[model samples]
Target: MTNDDLQFAHDRPIAMQQHDLLDRAGFAQRLALAISSWKNQESLVISLTGSWGSGKSSIKNMALEQLAAIQGSQVIEFNPWQWAGQDKLSSAFFEEISRVVQRKNPTEADKQLAKVLRRYEHRLNAGAAVLSGTAKWAPILLGSALVTTALGSVAEGTAAQVTIWTVSAVSWLGSLAPWLKQAAEWCTKRSKNLDQEAKDSELTLSQIRAELQKLLSARQKPLLIVLDDLDRLSAEQLKAMFQLVKAHMDFANVVFLLLFQRDTVEQGLQRAGFDGADYLEKIIQVPFSVPAISSGQLEAVLSGKLDAILANEQQLQQRFDKAYWDQMFQRGMRPFFGNLRHVYRYASTLAFHCRLLRGTEVAEVNAVDLFALECLRVFAPETYADMPRHKALLTNNEPFARQDEPQRARINQVINHLVFLAPSTHKPATRQLLQEMFPTLDWVFKNTEYDRQTQLRWLINSRVCCDDVFDRYFELSVPEQDVPNSLLHELARRIVDSGPFTTLLASHEEDRQAEILQRLFGLVDEFPLELSLAVVQTLLQAGDVVGRRMSFTNWSPRQQVVRLLRLFLLRHDDEAARSQLVIEAFAVGPGLVVVEQLLASEYALRRKADFGCLDDAGLEQLKSAYLCNLRELAERDPEAFLANPDFESYLYDLNRYGEGGDEGRRWSERHITSTTRFLQFAQTLVNTRSRYSGDGVTHIDEISLHSLDELLGKECCADWVARLDTGELSADASQILGLVKEALAHPARSETAEWND
Candidate 1:
């Protein structure tokens, strides 16, 4: 589309070709006729007041357009902000007025009026300059005046007073003469001929008024000078501009329409220590505020923009059906639509991103989600920043930590701030919009719960919100190339179809394969349960494909597969399925690393109260599978198994299970194999005392004693206990053996004793 096609109604005031959407109150028509039908009233100042971006400019433009059709009316548009920092506002105002007045067919009377206005302007400048100079030396001038007055008064007093005052005057004048002469010369150089200057200044306000009337008497139309964007001026400039219109711009047959955001200009005046309300009341003879835009009108305008952008894309357009569009408009876009400018800004951002991202083959993005994200990005940037950084919280998959409470509170505060800051009528809907955008916030706001599937669907559709779908949207550098969406879709289809894993692997480079697999794994969480199960099953059966690509990096194919399994087990609430999956993974020989991953996955689920995935039977089965794998590894290559980095965690898991439940006893018995191996394990624990010095000692001590007691009768281990009493063993070893001896001596009392002791 061309730039003109892309422009929204509010991008510029309703052009000649553009229809008026904001003249709902007929304020523009009334305003135009008001200016056109002006009688011989003194120069009138009419103010069009509204908040910034509240369609004031558009309304003014519409009124001016209407005025164009009125017979004999001449309109001049002047923007004070345009001349900002250039010259005094008063001087610029008169210059513009003169320029406009002089352009009335160049009649002799118009020429005289322009010439007289310029002369008034020059005289005003000269007077200001003279006053500025004189004010600078007022102290010296005052001192001389006081001295001369005292000398004159002394002559009427006693002889002694007269003599004293004469002496004082002489001393003061002797010190002040050089400064006085310099001040006089400064004034003389700046001053014009006194008599002629007075003659030029003879143009009084009344005479200027009469001359303006006489000049406009022959004209067929009234004069309308529209001054807009006054709020854009600096505080000093704003105050000066209004003051100039009040003092000098008042004339018969001329109408001045001043447009600005009321609060902005009033605040500017207040900042400059003026009674802003009173000042405005005096300057503006007729004040009219742009009425609020109706929802029907706003929706019409927004729909127009949306239709223009979506005109060519039937598929994208279908996504925004009537009900969906209405909901989104009322819930998302409508509340934030403060004015035409707001609509333009939001629509522009939506159009820009949609144009850039539409029809991309690599990412399966939803158009509505993209629009919602852009809305947040533009109107509520802080909320947007928080959303992506805390996605887990938004999705309710994770809770905010104690340390994050402050930030959570801040995010809530910002949301609340935006809610209150929104228009009062829209506050309720705006709050709902925020909750819809970030559902995790509902815990605090107590809003309705959004459908998780729908939320995830929307999230995955936008590149900004879904990191797995595409490269970071806000990153500074651009990617060299993006993976095609068609390729990703095909890869997913193949995996779902139970196609050969190596076929997929052989088709792409290792890195690309890893990214493809990662993206596939991302779908397990975003899609439904059946689809997720299919993805998990595909990964499970592709062990050889994954193993070949395993590397030290965390994102290797094996790790990706392992993570997908963990996510599946954690995310699905079926305990039997999770148990079966764990059993199958171990049965397939998923190495010691995958075993540890399974253990961690279960532990996290239990910790987060998300353990619906593994029931009692499933738990027993998972624990059994875990112990049996470790037992075989220990028997096959004990040293390598013990030397594995995950060994301690495995041991900890064993201790955790053996301390409670029937499966604990069976797990310990099945794993402890022989007395010699039990003793060897006990010895290993002692040798690694420093490693288990802190909280580790508790689990190690308990497990060591329990294993020794179970493998050998409690009484038969007396010799082992004696080795500890003889102090031949280290403190940690002795500690465990001593606990065994105590247990044999008094089982009940020892059971009650703290493990640390």
Candidate 2:
């Protein structure tokens, strides 16, 4: 079979037949020697104690295998937990011993041994029968005696009472005589049987021991009985098994190997009301606690499992070098290796994800980072949850000012909790390790300066562990039939080839098309300049299929295109390049959406305390470009521009006066220069209104008056005044002129006079 066909065997605890992880400590050989040296002696109980998954069972199996190779040794395997609810633990154990002994030596002496074992069984059964009889009759007999005594106490001084009592006593005696006689006969028979049984049991014990001694002497090998999974038994059953082995089952030439996790078994014993340590000490002659696996051994086993799972995947090997693996193992996975099952769990998780993402053309994902993440996912799930939630911070992409203090503190709490939950020796190292893997965490939690170089190196080497890659991983991890990776790959290829994105969208269902578009949207952020341009162009071209008005999250396809193009353009410092991209986007459709997006970015920059990384000149250039694009859209399609919902909002922004400074003066000057178009648009509104008669108001009158008021102090106000004086203005404009004159005549009082009123 191929190596790939070979299942990841270490996914579970290594079984006894599999000695791969067992031989590392040479436990089998050492234990075998210990057992071999105890030749035909009195019963020896050897307890292998370790934490769960610490290779106790594996060691026991190895030792048993070693014993199997020895001459004249007989091994009996018993699982007390399996027989737990089926029978009494002691009976099941003794029955197993008797069966094993019979199977080992089926001769005339063996028949005698069997007879002795039967006598022992009978002795236990007879005692149990006596106890059962007493439990059954004791309550009934006591109740009857209490009733008779109460009657005797109450029976007072009258002849009728005496006669009644006498009759009742007679009747009771007549009824009780038969039962008493039966009880007497039963006790007599039972007493006789007990005496005979005692004599037989004593003789049987002698013969059984003698026969065992002879059989063992002739064979020259000790009997090895391996009892495993005692921890799985209930508390009562575990205690009974221990008592049975310690009290009745101890025989010469016999060795009992009890495999258990010390703490779990001890807790069970304590809960069962026994002094666990003292009780175990009395029963276990030789206690061998399996030493922890060394770091070197753990590393070897983990690396071997990784190699097996990653075989034939050369790209992963190239990306995940020895140094990378070492860093992840030492930092993230090392602490988990106290138990070998942890190694299997993490490796299996990694292998599963690797196989999932194997041939897909995903973003560059470092194998070590994936493995480290899987370690967190498996061992520290709360911490793993924070990885995705605070991904931008962890990857050093989030701005310092934007970092959530509570979220940062929460992440620290999770890390500290994990460290505190770890072994004491490992706490410091674990904290350091997590800090190294996520350096931004050091900055957030420890207030240490972020190591940009180190973080950048990790980003370059292991992008998959970060936020963007994680998003993509989850996107691709879904079934191909559901998400269709091949279709996404095809879309990417077509985008590079400048193929029609609309054609691609037309082929899929609406929801599937949306999924493809969203995937492409994320890809735009990851792709390079050329590929990003191709993606934006595809989205623009797909307007036909997605429809010009098709909106998601309240954004049209054109708006989304504008959003992506703006992000792509900002990456380039070359103004000419950005302008060219803007022009190309504007050349398609009316490009009003692009203008809106640019204005939004400007407002965002204006709100930043330090303008982020952009200087005053860069900010000016962006704002200028925004206005220039808006002017182009207005000049190209004035009606369409006026009809836009943001048209009034844009005018308001242009007329806005900034707070004091050189910047404020510059903004005022720019607003004055930009009002020429505003005056012309105001004139259109004035002309649209008919001559007003009486004092009736109209929509055009309100529009004209509001526009004229907005231009009151600007350079465009004079042009409107000249129009009113020359009679070129309509009656509505003339009315606004009268209001302006009134305002000028009485500055404060005229302002209070409502023209519409």
Candidate 3:
């Protein structure tokens, strides 16, 4: 898995061992023809460009070995980056060529030249004698004499051993020149040559020109010198390396073969002040662009690595479970695109991990496992090191601060893509709302700026994102009518299960919580009950406090949320567990049966009037408020409050509100019917007051059958009306008179309205 465990033997192409090269027959044939052309032409340069790990190195290595078999051809298989200047480049390349030609096709001349070089080097080493027994001046004088005799300088004598070492190196080169010239001549003869001089030291540009003339004496055959693996170079270094190749090597017999990444290479070429297209053509007569591997090819590569564990005799056609494997492949393919390097790495790591855990290698891995592992790998320190922005945003910034634009934008991008590779965001309306939530993200880069279609595409291509569900959610945004369906679902579940959200929602009102409840109901078919519980609880809490009190006159996000909850809860069935919720909605203000629904419900006692949990004091506060407000309304125009359609239900529930069992119900019938009659009487008096005073006034006409007896209870009728009228209603003699009218409106002779008229 690492460089230490595996050695890449240059001669043996790994493609042959692993079946990754199977369907690449077309590519192989193209390479073969290209190689044949090179042999016929005598030299050439070919670029094998592809996404990371598309077998460029493997294929190039294989082709080089095959080319090495040619009789007259000699490949200088060296990376120019190994040295810095033109002199070092020329010296290293020509020296390697000299050594290879001598070793591979050693004539008697080459053999004698080699012998001379070795003997001369030995003699030079022996000649450096340390004069131990001589006087100190004698030793210095001896050193000076040797330096002047050989290296030709008095100053050089002080470092006499170093001077002698330089002489030996020169001698070695002198001895090897014959073979070097012969190889250079052969290269020149086979292709368009640069002229060169016959004398070794005189072999400059003029000599190169002469060499070109000699090479041109025959048909012009281009010689290619390929140098791949430039992808491993640093950005600036890669540009410099290519510049060296362009300036020194792009001439007569040679075309330079340079392989690098698309983006980096283009940028490098641009920095070097060369037209990338023209440079590519000049360096590569026929550039072999390796396209991203297909899904099918990737599968073959994965399967080939596990061939030892799987049956080789069985073809991929029928050996595996087609349906299951297809699903796994689809899932696996989701995270990665055409980057074969990452694919191989992912597969290898997964295979190794699988072997470690299961004791057997798996041919195909589960998509989820692959995805998680890939996530871990990408988020690892080494991978994250390559992405500074992602590192800074994810680590240094907090997503919660609304005004922190940079952090907010980063978090939005992260959430939108579910990863940090691209600046992810939704469309107009949804994006606007999101911006409101995290204001600082408003300036994020637009999607159109990148070549990808969706945020998902950018993430996948960048090898940073892979969650399909998360991607799809952001891809589709609906802010007009409601939050997108997926957003709703995600929010509902998230709010429900989150403790903070639960607490926030629990403190709000009922009607305000109903809207979200409706959304919850819609999703109950898919989301589980536990999740629903969390969501419902949140809505109830929010509605209970902030939501119910919210008014359109003072709109805000908190108020809106409460309003939504109200609409939500109104549609759901009243349950004992939701009893406090029911009261909170009614207690917020008034709406009769709606209020009666809570006041008379069994859960009234269950709601402890503390904070979100309504207790007896809270309920009493609501009761007192309602009564106080009602008394004020009645005094102004008693008919107005009593005329409300729900008045009867309100009185009925109030009479039976805290009573338990049938006897309580009987008392409720008696008292509730009487209260209704009293209100009706009050309405009539208000109507008469209006008619007599020639001013408009409201009144109630309906009376119940049990009212007469309650009004005639000796102290009850006059005492109650007089108390109400003299106290809160003292200024409204007309309202008191209306109450008397309502009591008198019932048949005086009747035992009670409950019996008959």
Q: Predict model 2's lDDT versus the native.
A: 0.58
The root-mean-square deviation over C-alpha atoms between each candidate and the true structure, in angstroms, is 11.2, 11.8, 19.4
Cα lDDT tens digits for candidate 3, 629-659: 4444434654553565444444444344323
Instruction: Point out the higher-scoring one by TM-score: 1 or 3.
Output: 1
Error of 3 at 216 (Å): 10
Shift in Å, residue 709, candidate 1: 26
* TM-score of each candidate structure, all chains considered together: 0.57, 0.58, 0.36
Over 44-142, each residue of candidate 2 has an lDDT whose tens digit, in order, gives 899888777788777766666666666435677889987744235556665776687678546765555556565666655555665655455454345
- Candidate 1 least-lDDT 10 residues: 683-692
Query: How much is 52 displaced in model 3, in angstroms?
Result: 2.3
lDDT of 1 at 731: 63
As a TM-score, model 3 comes out at 0.36
Winner of 1 and 2 under TM-score: 2
Look at candidate 2 and tell me the lDDT of residue 184: 39
Tens-digit per-residue lDDT, 635-681, candidate 1: 68765655554454456555565444333334434554544444554
Question: Which window of ten consecutive residues has the lowest lDDT sum in model 2?
Answer: 657-666
Best by TM-score: 2
Quantify all predictions' global Cα lDDT against the true fold. Answer: 0.60, 0.58, 0.41
